[model samples]
Target: MNKKAKIAVTRKLPATVETQLEELSDAKFNLDDTPYSEPQLIRAVSWADILIPTVTDQVNAKVINAAGPNLKLIANFGVGVNHIDLEAAEAKGIQVSNTPDVLTEDTADLAMGSFIMASRRFGECERMVRAGAWTG
Candidate 1:
C-alpha cells in the first residue's frame, strides 16, 4: 500500500481547507495560530513532504537547508513570498508557490473605500465630532 504524503501547515487555516487536507494526507496543523519558532519549523520540514507557510513564517536559507529529502514543496498561504528564500529552494530543487490572486478583489475594494473616505474628509469630520469641536 502507498503511504499518504505528510503535509505540515504552519498557521491556522480555515476549517474546511484543513479538513480536506487531513482527508487526503497526513496533515499537521498549528491550531494555536502562532507562527512556528525556528526549531519547530525545522522539525516540520524534516518530516513533511510539503510545508504550507504564511507571511509570518520566515522560510530562510537555514530552514530550507535543514529540510529532508522528502520536502519537495513550500506553498505559501499568502501572495507575498518575501519571507521565503527562493534561491535556496531553487538550489534544493523544492518548488515554491503562493496564492497571488486571492486578495485582488479585496485590495481593490479597500482602495476604493479609502479614496471615498479621504475625498469626503471623513477622518477630519470624525475627529472634530469626537473632540467636541463640531456642532449642528
Candidate 2:
C-alpha cells in the first residue's frame, strides 16, 4: 500500500471530521488532550505535511519558520487567522486556508442571545430563584 499523507491536528475535533480526514490521509491528533506548547507545536509543524489548527493556538513566526520544507498547507479549522503569522507564511511560500462561513450564524446567534440575557438581568432572576424568592 502507498504511504498516506501525514497531517497533524492541533486540537480535538468531532469524530466525523476525523473520519473524513482519516479516509484521505494519515492524521495525528493531540493525544494529551491539552494545548501544545510553542516548542511542541514547532516540532509538529516541522513533520506535518498539513496542519489543522484552532483559533486559540498561536502559530507565530517561529512556528512558521520551523515548518521546514515538508509543510505545504495550513488548513485552519476556525474562521479567523488572527493567531497565525500571515506574513511569515507568505515569506516561506506556505499556503494558509481557513473554514469560513461555517460559524457565522452560530456566533452571531450566541452574541445576540448573550446581549439579550445581559440586558434583561437574567442572572439577577436566577439569583432570585436560588434565593427562595418564589412567592406563588
On a 0 to 100 scale, what is the lDDT of residue 113 in model 1? 93
Worst 10 residues of 1 by lDDT: 11-20
The collision pairs in model 1 are: none
lDDT of 2 by residue, 56-108 (tens): 78999999999969898988998999999999999998899998998989999
Candidate 1 lDDT tens digits, 1-136: 8899899999998889999999999999998999899999999999999999999999999999999999999999999999999999999999999999989999999999999999999999999999999986
Q: Per-candidate TM vs. native?
A: 0.86, 0.86
Question: Worst 10-residue stretch by lDDT in candidate 2?
Answer: 31-40
Clashes of each: 0, 0
lDDT values, one for every candidate: 0.96, 0.90
Query: After TM-score superposition, what is the CA distance of residue 74 in candidate 2 from its true location, in Å?
Result: 0.9
Off by over 4 Å in 2: 115-120
Q: What TM-score would you give candidate 1 relative to the actual structure?
A: 0.86
